[model samples]
Target: MQIRCNQVVCLFALVTALAFLSAACSGEAGSLAAFLTPEGRQPEPTQTLAPTLEGEPAAPAAGTAQAALQAAVEALQGTPTEETVAAAGGRFPATPTAPLLTEGPSVTVTPGSGRANAWVTVTGSGFPANVRVDVYLAGLVSASALAAAPRSYATTFTDRDGNYSMSFAMPSTWPDGTPIETGTLAVLVATEDFGFRANTSFDFVAETATPTQVPPATLTLTPNPTATPVPTAMPTAPRPTAIPPPAVNPYAEVTPLSGGRNAQVTLRGGGFPGHSVIHVYLGTFDAQVGGGERVRYGSAVTESNGNFTISFTLPATWPDGTPVAPGRLLILVATEDLSRQASAVFDYVVPTPTPALNPYAEVQPPSGSANTQVTIRGGGFPANTRVHLYLAGLVSVSAAEAAPTSYASTTTDSAGNYSLTFVMPRTWPDGEAIESGTLALLVATEDFRVRANATFDFVAPTPTAVSGQSWQGSYYANPDLRGDPVLVRADAEIHFYWGTGSPDPALPNDEFSVRWQRSLWFESGLYRFTVEVDDGVRLFVDGNLLLESWRRGERRVLSLDYPMQAGQHTVQLDYFEHAGDALIILNWHRLSDLAPPPTGTPGAPGLLFSNHPWNNQRGVNQTFCSGFESECNYAGCVRNYRLVWGPYCREGDYPYIRPGLYRVTFYGIGRVRAGATDYGSSRQLFSFGQHEFELPGSFTFCWPGRQSDGYGFETIAQSTGVYAAIDWITVEYLGEQCR
Candidate 1:
């Protein structure tokens, strides 16, 4: 029986194994067999006959069955067979449909075992309608195996569009190890038959704060659907308004207070309205009252018209002990306004006592001769102050003063302006000529302590004359000598002539040869004589020749002792010349003799006497030499010979004097002796005589004249003369007796 049972078991095993193999092959062979058969065989019956095993090939035996089962599992495990997998679905080893979950859509948990609940929705494409999906807790899987099962929650239903969505929650029984922080919750989707899987993960975060009993402050977050809210509170105090002060007056005047008092200021301007204040200051000290230990005292208010007056009193104990002394005072005024303030300054002074009288004085008309007018002007004393003008080097005073004395006195006016004009005394001698001295005026008051003085220079004047005169022309009776008539006798007669010849061309012809004569009674003594003549002149005193200066325009002096017999003793002057102006003057005075008489028989009176009587006659005679004649040869001109020669003889001969008598026996004579060899061939030649004389006391003498070319002795050849001659013989006195 046991053998029979083992044989049954063995047979059942054989049958089951063969049915599995047949079923596996049946899927491949059914389509092939349908193609080979008549195509009328039904495929369902052939597939049913392929595999039949008891209870679907129950668990296999230990060794061999286990081996066979493993082979079958291996064949099913690695990759699905193409026929079976195709028969089951479409492909083998089914590809995953993504965005699937293999784990749960569980509640999130925190560290304190707190639970978090969420709802999930899933979407996919190319997934089956009734596909089974596995959901898992990603926390449940090891970190190393997370890629194998990435989905934490998943669902299987494809709602209307082949997409599946499911609600998930964290399990309450989960170990409190995996924190519910911000991470992905993976959801996997897979198929059961071919072991294909698909998955997706979504982010989740856990709350950082615990639940609180007190209500949170409310905060409203905007624009995000997931933002949380918070809360806060309110505030406290009041608002303030600004207040402006009064406007200042730019043109205000400050009045300084005296006697250590603060200044009072008045304001005048336009833009000040409403409530205002004013402040006063003294120097730099602003906060003092009327006495010591004081406080700020000047603040005040203004009226509506924008005008205010503020007064501040000073402290008795000042910082500088009363600044209003003599010339020193300073005060300052200021206005009190938060926006604008104005300031002004004031000063004051004190008086002093009068002084004593001043002492000073000055002088005028500094320096001049004595008797000069001097003036004195001064000041600085009482009215009617006595001013005494004094001389520095003289003794003159206001009355009968002596030499070197003071001279004048006066008084000052009410205005202290004084002036005095007085003549400097002539009798008051002040030093010498060109010497300097001072004329002082002294000023003094009644007290005599107030005294002053001033001094100036003094000088003298020069001298004068008695009687004098000057003369221009000759000393004779001519008008050129009288010269407009100085002091002279009334009947004085002056005589003048044109001289011997015609008037000189250089002189006026109206009075020539006219014998201009004037006579006067004479008083005689010494005289200054001047004579002007062209050729010669002789002057006589009492018919005695006194002086003869024969040259032209000569002057001399002489003293005559006239007898004073009263009647006129003739004073004659003889003048002779060819052609030129002639004049003579006789002047006399009774002067005492200041010199002695000359010695020896008085020298011959300066006069000339002529022996030729033809001198004064005008007509010409052949026997005489006329004044106009120029002689060439003498005796040949006949009995009384006078010959006139022409321009050539006048060019050669000049005049010489013999002073006294002369004679010419023959006018022209010459000689050539016979039988002399040199004379035998010679012609007759003319010669003239030659002689000279020196008289003793007798004045008469002769001169022998000669021509230019004449022999010693010869006969007269013709009657024509050589030049001119004068020949006469007489006896005359040649000494002082002639006068």
Candidate 2:
């Protein structure tokens, strides 16, 4: 395998101090050694260490080591100094021998990709029968084929047929943060103890794929007695054989898929025709593979035993030099004649997690009642990995349900707990909400390992009935210290914004008064009452005068918060209007939502009344007309004629009060017929009220309840009969002030 030249240069630089250690160990630095290693004795170099792979951080080169050695050698000659001796950051080869087998009885790994702490089956056959086989796993740094001396992981004797199999869990790390991706499966089969040992090796690296079906065919291998001593080369020609089909078929295996670039991986499988030329395909397997998403990795010939193992270096690019990125790579093996095939997968990139995560999970309010929201918080789970949660009754019968399928899944957050929340249903999917009891909730990673659980009792939510009582409205024909009402009816709420419509068709719309009151339920907490009214209005809670705007032609509102106790209380509203549009809106809230929001932006929770339509743009100078309510046609253009209305229009501002329902009532004259003017047509005794927009212009609110444009509502001609009149303007706050 070829390593980038740049890496070679860096590796040597980091190992310059190694020279001092070597020379001092030979007694060459008896006195100058203190200068070479000021802090402590320099350490010796390690043999069989992982070589830096293609994509690793650059290490200093042999040239760097030579230069540092030269500098140290000169310093020890007479001008010795710590600076000259100390240098930081490789293996220099002493000799090279050709690998024993170009084609050998090789190792095949069941799983090509996995986390460091996963077990894989290593199996190979056709070695010296009954011989001792020493197996080990070691990662390759520079290139899988370059150099390696892995530590022994297992020892076993081959069966009389010269076949051996062992399962080994991969170690979780490599030195210097080097990823554990590419490695060699080194097998030493010795004729006797410490005697001549014939070595058979194969390389592998992490690389992905799924099985894509191909035309079916079978492989049959006839072992050749001449293929002896295990590592000797056999015939490379193609030969077909007729044989009985074996009970077990052939399977493909590639090792060490969690690797980076330019490493080697070996492909091994059995039960192929003797001397068959097998083809290999690596990359995305397309249904129409001949055209795209696939490129041939190359081919190999099966030995006489129908078993074949071959090693090849990974390329940094496709056949066309399209750079191979860190992702998935498919491995496919087939007969050159297209008579047989098998496939496997390797996830090319073994990415390091951003945060070194640990496992922790918890369900808040572990013992909450049922039908309420419960949050399951977890921290340090594998980032981006899917997590599944299972709910089950804690009983011996629940064991079968522990199967991986019995759960719901969600992805984990990056670098933190995988937070999951859900409301327990009134009953379990099993239809059991045992009158009162607890159920077990378990959480496991998507792969279904490492489970954590908690138990909490719960109950079903029950419905409550509404109090049938509502507002009772009364009407009077004239604006005065009123007598008995002309009309009376049951009103659910005090939100009367009707214009021109009389409390009764029998009563007149103009010059009228209305009163409404009801009993309501309240919780013990801060409460607020918001009322929008026109003309004159007064409000009383439990007979206490909370707010009043008892003046004719006045348009205003009431808003504020007050403490309240849990119980039923009476609310009453008295309203009267001399003429024009009339409206009233009442609403109540609790706690922080009590105060009129910082700035009035319409549609805010506290918004009692706003004449302007919501067009998104608010608070800012309403210069551009993005098609406001009336002038919507000139959208996207600037219209200095702003359409916003202040709470203090021609009318006064809204009345400030506490959080509670207020009785709101309004009175207005009906619209005049077209072409008619004022309360009565000119030279005529009969006239009708005017529309609110036709009555006067509204302005934006100023500080302390004044129109930002100028004084009160722009004066206009009056109408004798009833019609509409805006009670107030609004820029109800969104929550807080935009400014």
Candidate 3:
């Protein structure tokens, strides 16, 4: 059987060879004899072979398609025999070495030529699959021009086959700011990063002119596997029909001609009493200058030329205070004596009811710490109605619906637009500090019937400083950093010249402030930092203030030279622009590699630290309690006599305190513990006083220069249950005590 199959395969190979030779030699295209046998008989139809014995290897059926194809491949390689055919189990595998295929990106624009604002369809193929691709229209078809081309304002995502289609109106100008005219422009489709791009051309013609015959411009399209097809005939856009305007009345006319109640309208007419007051009224033509007056809208004085124009809101009530029903009302323009009267018909139809929409609100910044002045805006509610805003958790809609007192209330405008600003509460309703990065709900509603919610992200209050080579800059709209930053970004340097321009659109050119901070590493050396400012600037290094000029000073230069250790250090600069020319430039240079002494008579004596009872204070582990019985006034304390007791944690007047012991004095009526601590804990605690008596004490600790920014002296009452009052405390620089 194998021998018979092998013979049949050889015969098939011979026949195929003969057929190819005859066709090539004779130049006959597709011949019917190509599938015929040697005797000119039609070939037999193919059929599946039957199964053979289980133990024995079955031979392929004679004259089968598989046998003949196997015979052809083997013959092309070398030869085929009965033993080889039987060993192969009558079937051979398909060719493994097939050609690899690939494709490149391409784009096309429909109705390739058009004027500005003409809608055009753009189709792209072979783009990055399932990714957003931007389409742009350029004045020039060059790589250099694409960078500045105006976008087509269309974006689309490619399908799995990397094809997308979108449409956008054509722009008027090109990349060079020139008007697109009588020339071919490039249409570009590219990813956001411009990693992949394709370009085609568009002919821009004048609006009233026809597109003349022109040569196709060169396109920047990638090669694809298949050849792109060209359209034989281009499509023409249909001309838009022009509509005739409504005829205007010769004697008098209203600009809009018709509107609902309260709608503003402008009436213009000639031949009215000049230099005279014109009383406007909404009524019928017969009612004007006759039986009585009608609904009198305000009056206006006419010009000297006897031509008058009056703008007023449509009245909704008559002169007798009765409601004016919706109908066609005439606006009568006449003098007080009814001498010159002109009338124009105004159709006061019923206002079309607005379609219902789901109410929604959004908060600017979307996330912030406590006291962040959140601006909430709402829409799609009842107009001229109050909307209550609440801060709720993400428990459920039911939980938010049951909130008691609203955080704030604001009324929507006549167009159903609501907006309000409120300070975010420091804690939740349950008196818990709002956790950082927690999701909170901000609901806006009118009696809960029309309610909408938005998510507010609660971030930590204190900004965590990060280490970088550049400055992390924050810009605020106000001089004081009281609200969310207008702009937060990384700045490579602290040089700016915002003479009449602002750092950000949200901030004003004047009265704006900025804070830039960065942790930088440096080698042990003495560095000189210089700053030239128009207004004021404060520089701090590792919490130690090196320069302080927090005032409105004209352009001035300040420099400070300090020795720094070989490690990481933080630098911060705060500047404000009050008015006029604004500019600030900060720079630092290592003066020398030599390290200076830690302590010495570097400068003249100056007051270092003083604590005020009513100044800005932070509480730790306890809340402050105010009492009328305790006193607050002292020589170095706030003038107010109110008393508050808690952790009297006050930052000293100096952040980077020099190495000095100096003198520490405490005058207060309370038990107090004072020392220099990192946070609120001190190893060398100086305890003094009894709760029932006034304690005046003084003590000094070894002065050790701080290497970082936050180490400072702090004081806390021994117990909050007792009367612990801090009247005055001062730290004076006695001399170089550490060295």
Candidate 4:
């Protein structure tokens, strides 16, 4: 019986296998048949069966391979299980199926063909969730526009389902550079992060094409059946309203706070009106419609979320071409309506400054007499340039340039330093003598901007008095000098200040007298004799009293000019002190050589009235027997013009004469009253002679000539009949007048 069962199984397997083979030959359930075949059993290759002039075998009945495999399995189930089938010589294997394919991001446009400026709707799916998806027109009609940066016309954000929809007009021309005509326009959509991307194309046709004839848009993914096709019109979706931004304040910030010109900076802003045009500028704000000095750097359209980021380069100048200075500046961002604004602060960097050059000069010896060689050293000038030098007083540059004292020019070395020498000049270029003890500046200059100066002190030589010109001094114990001198010595100069001390052990400080005598050889010049003493003092040049103050008085100075020939002359001075400080100073110096007047010219007579010698004041004249013979003028007896001792004659009332040295001459014989009390009280009667008197201001004097008649001389009131012929009295200026 088992044999019989195996036989039945074998018979059914054979028939079932034949059916599987026929199905496999028809390419139906071939994989299942192959799996059901026993292992290690090879199927014989099948031969093509020629048609019996009958139609080719009908195609296998239409059915799923799985369903056909299941029917085949049912047929084999009647035969045996897998193990049983294995025991009965049968095997089957299982294989895995691949996961189902999923579509990536894709985009499409309605109406495959469109005219320029025609609106089109865009649809997309399978992009990142809640991500910005930019839509751009690709395959520009113009080949040249293809190489430029991609420009987006429409933008949208994907929902959680990765779907988006937006509409925009077909660009009439390539937005960047060239024009678009009849050609294909590709639509590309991409996630902002580029994680997913898809593209499709549409036909861009001229306006001549009818909208009804346009074909449907080609898509990168399966087309949506629900999308309606326009027959006679290109229906554009309603333009999306601007997304209202959230109630948040607008704010902006930059990457770097400070930068120089041409520096690249990145800017970020938020909380702006959605889909609004935002402009960026650098300047202050103004209420005027034309705006202030604001310059636009760039513009941007905010996303639906009201946020944006942009990058730009800093400009070097303002809109008005003014250079941007260093300071804190504002970066202004505002909406198109200027209703919203945000600002960021930036610092314009300042450049480092260059150092300045200053030139200076110095001399070796800053002071000397004329013809002194001076070396000037300087630096900080332009290298290898010429430097002009000048010696100038406290004067302006132009004045110094016009009259420079010994200028020199030299070229500086490579180090912008120089050294040179110049002799100090006695006179300037204008022939003006450089006086003694003058201070001047030595100026060095390379150009108007480069100059330096050094001081040069010009001093003239001064004469010195030596011991070879000493005074023989004699000191007495009594002011009257009744006794011999108590001390005798040689004083280099007649200068002493005993104060409260005695001059010598034998002489007392007060009620003492001193005498100084010297024979000096003068140099044919007008000499000034200066005497300063306390109490009483007197000066005599060759026995002629030149200056006298022979009375107790305060220490005072008296000066007079004496004209002396180039020969030895006796100079004597006597001083007496009664009390208090004892002081005496006597000295003489040559003023200048005498320059007498020519024969017939009004010399520099400081004070001269008339030429007639007798028109002077002939005051209170008296006439008597006159023995002295001389020219006499109008007097008591105009016929003889003789004057006696009794109120003889008064000198003319001179006009207001300035203070100066003057010489009075008497041409008549007889003792003449030659003293002037207006000058000083050191008056005395003297014989006819010429004497110099240093008159003080407002001087008045009277001169009476007493003739030495051979009659009994008596007092002035009891006229002794002394007659003197008076001549014209003349006054000559002998020294510089003090105005």
Q: Residue 95 of model 1: what lDDT?
A: 32
Q: TM-scores for all candidates?
A: 0.19, 0.22, 0.33, 0.22
Question: Candidate 1, TM-score vs. the true structure?
Answer: 0.19
TM-score head-to-head 3 vs 4, winner:
3
Model 1: residues with Cα > 4 Å off, grouped in runs: 1-251, 255-279, 284-301, 309-330, 334-341, 347-354, 358-739
Q: How many clashes does the backbone of model 4 have?
A: 1
Which scores better on lDDT, 1 or 3?
Answer: 3
RMSD of 1: 54.2
Candidate 2: regions farther than 4 A off: 1-311, 314-361, 370-373, 379-382, 388-410, 413-417, 421-435, 442-452, 459-739
Residue by residue across 509-561, what tens digits does model 2's lDDT show?
Answer: 77888887777887766565666777777667777654545666445545544
Pairs clashing in candidate 3?
A: 542-709, 544-656, 662-734
Local distance difference test scores for all models: 0.34, 0.47, 0.56, 0.53
lDDT of 3 by residue, 585-613 (tens): 99888877753333423333444445443
**Superposition error at 146 for model 2 (Å):** 12
- Model 3 bad stretches (over 4 Å): 1-358, 362-378, 385-390, 396-411, 418-450, 456-465, 593-739
- Candidate 4 regions with alpha-carbon error over 4 angstroms: 1-469, 597-702, 706-739
Error of 3 at 223 (Å): 99
| Alpha-carbon shift of residue 377 in model 4 (angstroms) | 79
